[model samples]
Target chain A: MSRIAITGIGIITPLGDTLTLNRQALQEGRSGLSSLEIFPTKYASLLPFGEIKITDKELKTRLDVTEPGVTRTTLLALHAFKQAVENCGLSASEIQLSETAFINGTTVGGMCLSDALYQDANFRETGSEYLNSYDLSSVTLYIQQRYGITGICNTFNTACSSSANAIMYGARLIQNGFVKRAIVGGADSLAKFTINGFNSLGILSSAPCRPFDNARSGLNLGEGAAFLVLEKEDNVIDKPVYAYVSGWANSNDAFHPSSLSDDGEGPYLAMQQALQVARISPKEISFINTHGTATENNDEKESIAMQRVFGNVPAFASTKSNIGHTLGAAGAVEAVFCLLNLIHDEVYASLNFDTPIEATGLVPVTEYKHMRVEHVMSNSFGFGGNCSSLIFSKGQKAQ
Target chain B: MFYIHQSSCISHQPTFTGVDLQNLQPSVNNQLPAIEPKYINIPLGQLRRMGRALRMGVGTGITLLEKHKADGILIATSNGGIEDSITFLNQIVDYNEGRLTPTHFVQSTFNAIAGLLGMITHNTGYNATHVHRGLAFENVALDVTMLLRENPGHIYLIGGVDEISVRNYRMEAMAGWYKKEPISNTELYASETEGALPGEGAAMFLVSNNAESATAKLADLKLLHTADENLVANQFAEFVRDREIDLLLSGESGDSRFKRYYTRCEQAVSENTAIARYKHFTGEFQTASALALWFSCWLLQNQTLPEHCIKRSGSKTAFNRIALYNNYQGVQHSFMLVESV
Candidate 1:
């Protein structure tokens, strides 16, 4: 199989708007979990959120978007998409080619404007601009419409693992000869719909989330977007390859809606299958970016899953502690973090970690350090037991 | 060759168990709802929790799984379980985000149907749901074909489902998604209108790479995202230039904005090439093409095209090849080719 190289990356998160900004924050170990800023809600000051500090207006203005029916979700996605395509130097014609596919992942589409939609749907006499943008396809549609993207476009909603699956599907499309290039990623924004939805599930923590910790309370909701420009290894000429997507897999627990199985069967299968695809052993893997959401079930199950895979675990950390679970964007954002690990030859610290879980007795890499990095595993487990893991190897010429 | 071994469809027509869409009476109500079967195997408690979309999707998907085991489950839904989502959102507003119920939120996610299928069938392999409007089913079908190519012997249960959310329907009416003055199914094509009649249904297919006793093979599928007039007029011709098309199942909603694309397809084909329209039998929705694929499979198995489906007479009497062309509001377009085993 020919390698699928990652030629470009674009990310916008609570930590920062640009990839460079986020890299610095990851090095400094700054936590982006603070109270909500742009969204006006009663829980704005009460609970912690990984809300992007920029207002909707600022985002729109920066993106030069003034179109109706465009939501904060679309704006976040467009921002990262533009940066990614630009960084990869894909022309408009190349992007519009039928061989160029656009696969997007988002759980929160236009629902970011749920309040506006509700206000217009019931009270107002006329329809609001947000009526068409409230579904899961709105963000991808907006990007497609704006760019006249005509290729195989798709929007996935596998709960939080949406974007990870998006990336995997893109690579599969390339490997299977469906498309030569794919722009794959996801974007989500802080919305009352999700906030209250998570709150109803009683998974929202008041304090900043501490993933992989013994006393980790719960996950803090976050919002962000990231896009990876993946091209068949043959086409990425003279481009600085951050990393190559070597292997990826998706496995379901089939256990519970919100929780994984007792021994993390989903995670174990996903990680094991991903390793088999990558053709690398556990000892060869330098770091594992765990999906430790700090929720009572996820962190422990994920730790146990790791133990089953690698008996003596390598340096592992969950950056969700730095920036709360970004739902759809977490996978791609953390994929970029993995690329950063490979490109910069370093691993960032997992913040707010005091002690390891008693059951696993495993401690994460607590301090940032330059290290020998070869292959990095990024894991993302979403609601509905959709567990996925992707392995990135140091880039080389296509075989 | 990728083949469909078994299938299930819950449409407005009674094609679930008896499988007789040919006898569907002519009534062109603007909104076409699925004539669902009695969900016998699904537990009543779980059914109570599911909204229309969830029940219909999971019901049909699980049925196919009961008959044959699949390596994966891929679902296509444009607006999945929207009513539940609306209910959850309304509750958040009504109760001021206070003491809210969690079931609605849990069941509202687009992939909830796929998740439920994994739990019930206990077949947890590659699970996915595609939510792109119009392209939902088509894209997922493409995904299934790719998965089959990657792993040669895998069978997948693929489905496309959607339910009418009264709130979303009403809201879409404001944007002219439905006709201002609705008409009956008999008068759908005759009555001049710019909008389509809202419709919803669920369709499931058991597709496998190893085709031994397959009903129909999905030979080729293509999409035309550009509404370029030149491309629309020429794409259908290009797909059928080599293959002898026995039937062309066209999804032409009565909306005239898209009538040109259908006309272009009709003009591209010969008079001997049989053409038929399906939306009149099953109203226009995002995943209606899935229903069309199901209908094509039925026609191949039964060796007959229902009288109501035929739009133009064709030369070939025996239908061995079928083509499906569908466009959603003249924006997203698809051209697919199917062959009988």
Candidate 2:
């Protein structure tokens, strides 16, 4: 079996639209969190968000989507997917081939239009234009149809760890000879549904999130999309490989619906298993991209978990402090950022940090610095105790 | 080969412990009532916060793990936690005044069942949830087959659960997915209805590489999504050409609009081959095929083919090989082959 090589990376995040812009902003310690402007919400002025600074109308015009009922979730997905595929220079025949799989992860999906669907279902005057778009598979179906992909297509909704699982599933497909290439990523758009849902959970912060800070309040909801094109090492021999999807694992806390256990067993197991899969020691992991939802529970539990795995933790940061929690898209978006770290040999700062949690006292990398990063571990923990960790290496390890 | 070690289904039919194929009757009501499993015994505090789908999924998982061991857990759902989602949305619209409850939001994710399974089983090795409409169960099957192929000795728990609510049924009804005139589910296959009777259920299985005391050998699983009926026929031929298919179970949902796809598949098989159908008894949902899989395993284990399921009676001598063809609205087509080990 050939190694899984990530050859293409694309992202439309709160910080920037392209990889270049995002890299520049990250290096400069700039944050994308601010007052929400694109959507109408009661918390617009109270809570800061990592909102993509583009209107859905302009996105549709740019992507040339003439059809209705295409939610912002699908629109953002198309923007990132197009870039990733183009970056790899996949031919039309290659894209139309039956060997290419597309795996998407999303929490918002068409639920962004939940209000419109409600009106349509309640009032009979307006015909339901979004009847087909209400399901989670709507985004995958739209992408499959647009790209004419006939191979395995799936959508995963595991909350925050969704896209991380997608990336792992895509790599598994290629490793098992089920597919030659997989376009794996996730997209989530802010909506009344998520806003109200998170609000009810009492985790939406009024200010920018402080991921590992002692006085951290809560997480700021964000909207964005990221995709990576993974192919077999043999097929991408001449291509510029971004990084290797080295190791991955998923573990559950089984403790609470929304909170991890005090021991951080799930997070610890996921990280340990991922390192085992990569055939490396904890000391080899140069940096850790913590899940760092900035909620009181997540940061402390993750810190304890890291301490258990690595006696002294590596240089770590939570991009969530910069872009807020992207939910389903966080895993893939952070994975892309990890790849950028490997490509540029640098580390980005975790913004809005004053003090570390007293229990763990683990301080994160607070300044951008050029360093040697051979392998990076990204963690994504979601509701219902779904936790996933991924290890991306600077280059392929010997098979 | 993927061997069925244990299986469980919570559906309208009497299939929890073992399938009662003899006393099968067509559902009189359009919405067949879901049977509550008496086997689940979680704590009352945790159980109080659970919904039907979540409870059923976790209960099925616990049952499957009772007599067997699993290294991984995989679950599938077409619409995950729809009841909770609808309730949350309803609260959002109706009571948009105060803070909405977090229970609905917490239970609304598609992987809630898988997460719960992990928690209940505490065997969190590899976990994933596939959420494509009709292909949900099939996707999980593919994953199981692949995993077993990679690591031969390890067992896996695979399940598919989907529940229907009034809101979802109304949405489908508004989309013209139901018959205009009310008709009994028994007349589903023959009636001139435009839609299949909507239904819901949860089914789980413990599959392993070991065949000792196994129910059946999962020979192969295939899925196709194409507009051409000829391509489907060709693929179906390729799947069963070498094997002696003793019985063929077709997803003949009572929708006239897509019944021709089943007919095309039937034409691809031999004339003397025995044919069977099961949608009338199970109702229609995304993971209804999981129930069909359970029924097929029951047949293979007992070495009997129920008469009511037989559409065209060939020489049903001794059940050795069986095949299942499932499709939803002429899309998300799949075939599963099972053989006596």
Candidate 3:
């Protein structure tokens, strides 16, 4: 079997725009959560969010996009992808004129644009032309046109687990000799739709969300994009490698449409499958990047799954406390953080920790600490019991 | 070889349980509404949490599992729960971006159906959802076949579902993608139209390693993301000829803009071999080809083709090899070959 290597990474997160800046913010325990102010929503002043502080015009200019009025989701994807393509050190011709596949995962592609158009009273006369491009497929078409990637381009929308599945499929394609390389990940932007949706579930936390904490309330919505350039191991020997996607698996709970199973059976199976594929044991796992959405059900169920698999809990934290939940982009963004952990060899603390949850007795690493991290497992669970786990190793050469 | 064990479809047609191929009653021109059976009666509390798309997806998925009992599930949709998403977005817009409900938001995600199916069946196994325009179902089916080849014991449940909303219709109309003229779906191929009438449905299948009572043993599947007509035609011929296909299921929506691709396929195959079409019954969407697979499974298991599907001046033979060719507009071209065990 061929090995899969991560040769390049690009990120446009609330923590910062560049990967370096995001890593610095994580190390410094700087929280990107603040009162939402970009869009004119009543929830903007009330809900705490992890919003990227940039205007639409600036984002368009930086990403070299001609259509400034396009969805913010597209702009975010372009911003992250540009950095990823550059980081791979591949010439523009290689990316724009090659057979490289772009497999993206996104939950809300152009919902913001649709909302903006639908709200205008003169939408029927003035904004009708733009309504056709508001679906998920159009977003992928836009990106494909911009990059000139005539290869297989598709979008995965399995909620938060969307991007993890994207990465896993990209690796499978490389292993199966389908495509030589792939630009895979996901992107989503803050919209009133998500904010009120989480609020309706009665899970929104007015204060900072505390993951694995007994006093945890709910998750804060955030927006961003993360992309990785993956190639067959032999194709990226001399390139500056970020980390290897050692193993990954996706499983369904089949329990409920929106809620997770009580035993966390699906997540447990997915984690176990990923380990089997990586040919590693639970004891060998150095750290874990948990999908702690700060929701009572998610935190509790995920911790139980962790306990069942690992007996002794590994040091883990939820970056959602700092960057908010980026929905489809969560998996890729968290994977990026895992690679950063390997580079720094330090465990960044989970922000807003107060007390451990009573049911699981799980306490996340609340303070940054220097540690010799080797392998890290990141998990992302979405609405449809779509549970995915990805294992990122320290380096290509292995420890 | 990965073999299809059982397949089912719950569309406007009354073809759910039996293996016999029945001609569907055209519902396109009728003013009388055609409604599906109450999803709640299919099971308990299954429809409570699901929106229309989720209900259709899980309903078909459960029916397949009850027959074949799969170990994992894979689902594909071009636009999942867009109605719910539109409703949620409208609420946000109407309320001046104020407090909005979460049910629609939670339901709007594409994988929600696969996740729900996993939880209901207690089959905590590999799960995934693909949403690639017209090839969504083909990509997911290919993934299932690949997984079955890699891991021998698992019984995989793969499904493709898409829903039609008022907003979806209006949006497609604005883009000049759907036809404005009314025509019976059954007569979709009879005319020289340039565009297809949009429709929605769900199809699910139980695929297993064991070839017991298998409809067909899946031979090979391929998807190419290109628009070059000559390249697509050449690839289709090579793929089918290599697999020794004796029959072909062409995705002809009767749209002249895209019908040429299928016509090219007809010209390539031998005249003695049978040719069939299915999108006229299922409508066009990302995963509509799953319907083509469902029809293929029916023919392979029963050893006969329905009269409604006859497209060419050729007689149906005791064919044991079949190939499915499908595409959306000019992009996302896919080919699959199946043979009797």
Candidate 4:
């Protein structure tokens, strides 16, 4: 049997752009969230967001892309995608191989320019420049056309679980012998479309989110993108691997469109099935990167599910407390965080924590600690009750 | 191998549980709206709030689930809830995000309909939604293949859905997707125009390893991102190398620039193989190929050919082996092979 290994990783989030900056912020327990900047919104001063600092003009100029309707969503995806391929040491010819695939996921595909699109749709003139860019397929098509990637290409949208499913699909492609490697991840940029949508749900927290805490009001919406290059073991050879994708499973709650069941049936089945796929017991998992969106409904349900899976719950923390919930990109971002925990042999603190929820009485790791992590599980639950879980283990363990 | 245990669809043609398609014909109208089912059994409160896409999807799925139970659900849509999305976008602009309501916003999610089906069916496994424009259905089909291959004995409910929104129609027409000049849908091929007529529909299928009651067996499938005629021809030849193809379903829309590709395919294949077209009756959308899939299964199982769909007759009267070739705006190309066992 061959293992699917993560040969490269890249990210652009509220914490930082480079891996070094993100690591430093994690060590110091710093928060990447702040008042909305660079984006125009009525709630700019009234609410906080996980907005990336780079302006749209700077992004376009730096990326050398001057397309008229090119949105921030596409730009952010390109930025992270470039870093991931470059880090994987994939050469030009190798990138064009028939067996190298590209899979991406995003709910906010090109709609980051919602206002512009709305205005463009009302006009009585010729085709608008933003017209072509507005399609959900445009982002992946642009990247494939630019790099000449001829292998299998696809884009998925499963709400918050988009990227996690993207990663799992990539791994499945490799495992099924359809491809030798796959570049997979997702992207989403903060825009009024989602902000207002989430605002209407009344799930936006006024302060930094507090996951696993009793008084946790709601979540803070974030913007970011992340990508990981997964390659078959035989193809990777002696190259450095961040970790091996050990197991994965996906399920739906079938209870509600936005909230999970009271008993967390969906999350329980997903985590339980993932462990079975990994061929490990719940005791083998040393840490967990939870889908703790800090929303009152999610945190509690996730806690109960955790207790059901692990009698003595493993050490777990929600990174959203630091970077906010990145929505479509949350899965891959948190997966990369799990990879970091495996590589650095340490776990970071979950900030803005005070008291545990009365129902589960589970307290997340509120302080940074050095530990020898072996296997870790990352959870990502999304709207429409879409739930998924992935397990990653130290690379050496694969051999 | 995965076989289709059940197949159902709701399209512009009168295709449903027991509707005979002998009366099918191409229309002169540019827009091919789906023929919605009455769904008399659905509760009034729930039926009143559902959108067009939801109606076609859940309506068709419920019809199939009555006879079969699916453990996994997968759906594909190019523009999910476009009506709701347009409403939300306009609301944000009209109200400046201050007086926004959650109705359209909640329903605007691309996977909203798929999630609702999961809730109704009480299916909690492998819920998936693919949204890669014209290739959405093909992607979901490939996913179903992988999942079934990994775990046999489980059945999957898969389908493709898309609905025409007024705003989307006008905006996409401005982008040169639909015909600018009013023309007959039947003349879609004769007109030397640059765009196709807009259409929408929903089609569902149950795939499993069990072939006892199977309609057709999925033999082989492949997806490509190429436009070179020679490469496509070579891949097509290799796809049907050892197999005998009795029929080939072409997904050529009426756009003048893309007519050559279908012509090229016809020229590439052996003359003994019959060729049929579906886009003329179904119009064109991202997931329009779904209607083609349902049609293929129906033809293979019933061994009947509708005069409206047949462009040419082949040497073999029975379609033992069939292939579906489609390209979306010359970007996404797919080849699906089905067999009668």
- Judged by DockQ cut-offs, the docking class of candidate 1 is medium
TM-score of each: 0.98, 0.97, 0.93, 0.98
TM-score of 2: 0.97
DockQ (model 2, Cα): 0.59
lDDT of 3 by residue, B221-256 (tens): 777766778878988778766454567888887777
Steric overlap count per candidate: 4, 1, 11, 2
Q: What is the lDDT of residue A189 in candidate 2?
A: 88
lDDT per residue, candidate 1, B1-341, as tens digits?
37999999998888778777778555444788788788987889899899999989988988899999989889999888888888888888888878787899999888898989988888779888899888999988889988898788889999899998888887877877887785777667765769888788899999998678899999998876777767877877898787778888889898878888888887777778898888877888899999999989988888777777777777787888988889986778888888887
- Fnat for model 4 comes to 0.73
Give lDDT tens digits, candidate 4, residues B204-236.
998998888788898888888877777777887
Q: Could you give candidate 2's per-residue lDDT for residues A228-308 as a string of tens digits?
A: 999998888667888999999887777777888998998999999999878899999999999999998999999999999
lDDT of each: 0.87, 0.85, 0.79, 0.86
**What stretches of model 1 exceed 4 Å from their correct place?**
A396-399, B25-29
Q: Which 10-residue span in candidate 3 chain B carries the lowest summed lDDT?
A: B27-36
> Which docking category, incorrect, acceptable, medium or high, applies to candidate 3?
medium
Fnat for each predicted structure, in order: 0.65, 0.50, 0.74, 0.73
- The list of candidate 4 runs beyond 4 A from truth reads A397-399, B25-29
